[model samples]
Target: MRNYFIDLLTKEAESNNKIMLMVGDLGFSVVENFKEKYPKQFINAGVAEQNMTGMAAGLASEKFHVFTYSIANFNTFRCSEQIRNDIDYHNYNVTVVSVGGGLSYGALGYSHHAIQDYALMRSFPNMTIYAPGTRSEITNCMKQIFKSKSPAYLRLGKTLPKNFKKLYKPNHCAPGKWTKILECKNPDSRKCILTTGAVIDDAVQMQKKEEFSNYHIYSLPIWGMQYKTLQAKQINKWDEIVTLEDHLEDGGFGSYILECNSNIKTAGETKIKLKSLNKNVCNTVGDQDNLKEHFKFAH
Candidate 1:
């Protein structure tokens, strides 16, 4: 996923010099290709996340679409004030690229944990959250990011799926719209496992379990507070929705879905179940799979 992001960004930069990438001291080997190919459009902002975000806003004020890249917690929580005031407040074209989201960097401990990132990023009124589930969804999200002229948060995972190129379908993705990934044998099944971000892999795994075998699988890659009404409408079509995410339940993707239909009038008859990471795993240290198992994240 990291390699794909750099490859896609590098290609986009070729046609638009206004598209720039500013990174902290991290992303060394993963970002070298983009840095070497687009020297003029790249900046190494050292370890200061706040300053990097401010600089991104300044460049965005000049009509440039700048992306601030770094580890999930550093680029987000560490520089949240800058992101909220400098970029989001002014509606700058800055995309906060957070790699190693969730427990991807769990071995480094809580300092690297990004399970609470969505809670912070989604609170920004002008910000759009792009949590692509597949390589194809990543491409679709990049298109929407370039089309919009506002702040965005691009959450990326550390690893790619096995045989991903051949396994994923090349599908189109739209904001607030569910992209159907897998269909159950029952054509009229209204029950589905809906998810966003890399946790879509977990949804697939759950489908193989007895509890979710009859559910269709769907992924919503692009969404934000502004899409509530759209989400309610989509929610109305389903009889049951099981939302999954790697983040905590509070202010996470599942919570967002509930908020969309909170109003009695907007709240349909659909049964919505939220499956998110247990808070107990926040401070634990382990590899991605082990940390996830500590809380039974996929269950």
Candidate 2:
């Protein structure tokens, strides 16, 4: 996901001089290509995440589309004040790029865990959340963020499959719209699993199981506060919707989905089930797969 982001950003920067990238003293091997190609547009902001975020906001104020890149926690939690006051508050065109979303960096311990990132980013009024589930989705997400002029969050995993089959056409995605990935055999089956990030793989695997064979699968790569109305229109199409996410249940994708329906009088009939990582793995230190097992998210 990181590689794809840099490749796309580098290509976009060639045509659009306003695209700038700032990092918090990280992304060594992965970011050098962009730095070498567009030296003037790239900045290594040392270890000060707060300053980097502020700089991104400052640059965006000058009509530059700035992207602040770092590990999930450092980019979001460590510099949250700057993100809120300088970026989202002003509706700057700054994309907070967070690699290693969810438990992707679990081996590094709790400090690197991004389980609560959605809860934090979603609270900001002008923030747009881009949680892509596959390489195709990542490509679409990058294109959307590049074109969007608002403050956005791009959540990515540390590693991803390169040759996996694409679930949805990348160009068909739009903010708050759900893309149907796997259709159930019976057209009458209205139960589906809706996922927003790397958890889409788990939902696909679950659908292949005999017990869940009748369930469909969908991925929502883009969503946020302003897009709640779009979700309300889609919720009535499904009788039972299972929302899956790597983050904790509280304030995660499922919570957002429920919030979208809370104000609609007719939405109470839909059964929404949230399947998220259990808090038991909050303190565990292991690889991504190991931590997922501890949280009962393993396939």
| Count of backbone collisions in candidate 2 | 0
For each candidate, what TM-score against the reference? 0.96, 0.96
lDDT of 1 at 118: 93
Determine the C-alpha RMSD for candidate 2 after optimal superposition of all C-alphas.
1.4
Q: Candidate 2 — which residues are off by over 4 angstroms?
A: 161-163
Q: For candidate 1, give the lDDT.
A: 0.88
Put down candidate 1 lDDT per residue, 195-289, tens digits, no spaces: 88988678878888888988998888899988766887788888999999989999999999998878548465889999998898876889989
Q: Write the per-residue lDDT of candidate 2 for residues 136-233, one digit (tens) a residue.
A: 78888888998899999999987664435756555668999998777877768989889898776678777888867888988898999988889977
lDDT, candidates in the order shown: 0.88, 0.88
In candidate 1 the C-alpha lDDT for residue 210 amounts to 88
TM-score of 1: 0.96
